[model samples]
Target: MSKHPGPSLAQHPMPWWRSGYLWLIIGLTLAMLAGGVVTVWLASQQPHAPVAAPPSQAEQGGSLEPAMQARNRTSSRNAKALGTGGD
Candidate 1:
């Protein structure tokens, strides 16, 4: 046996804070959180207009009767016949 008897250096575990993979994971998590915060802030800065309600049936002169249904059916049929619509 050798005269010197000390613990081997290879048996030591690295500190958690010194790990590259751990730092990469932490950086990615922070980046994603920052991106989410920025996205929310930007969305909040957008213009939010009040939606307008559609005219009432009486105000539209009751045009949504059988005529509108017939026109829609005819248009859909024409589109399908022309191969411009999904079958």
Candidate 2:
């Protein structure tokens, strides 16, 4: 028999914070964090891929130009109709 009676694992359970499993969890967490940082750095270092340019207003025809064109056509048609009916 031992001179000093020490508490055995069977007698008292070690708290989770004092366990080897806790260290493993901490290690895995740090590893994942490091991986994420490295990934972000690598991504930032690379040049961005070219993106398609959006359609421009001038290329699509000016908005004001289209509205003005529509107004002119409607006015000319009404003038012609009124002229023919009144005669």
Candidate 3:
């Protein structure tokens, strides 16, 4: 065999922290942990207000009549176009 040995047979192997891949993995994990902590803190600081329910048609006093008429007109037009005679 030659006097020179392969890298695997070296007397001292590289340390874990010195590895580029290890550093990359560690950095990504720390960044994700930081992001999660920030998100949780923000969520806790400003909780959403309770939403109010919308009034029903009767409660709103027939405000949707015009919209209903327009919807009926559109339905009849579509039915006529399809030769269904608008029922």
User: Judged by TM-score, which candidate is best?
Assistant: 3
Q: Which stretches of candidate 3 lie over 4 Å from their true place?
A: 1-11, 46-48, 51-62
Q: Can you write out model 1's per-residue Cα lDDT over 1-87, one digit (the tens) per residue?
A: 769866676778777899999999999999999999999999899678989899898798876678777888899999999999933
lDDT for each of the candidates? 0.87, 0.84, 0.89
Clashes of each: 0, 0, 0
Best-performing candidate as measured by lDDT: 3
**Residues 1-87, model 3: lDDT tens digits:** 669765683667888778999889999999999999999999899699999999898797778778989999999999999999895
lDDT ranking from best to worst? 3, 1, 2
What's the TM-score of every candidate structure? 0.44, 0.39, 0.60
Regions more than 4 Å wrong, model 1:
1-10, 48-87
- Cα error, residue 65 of model 3, in Å, equals 1.2
TM-score ranking, high to low: 3, 1, 2
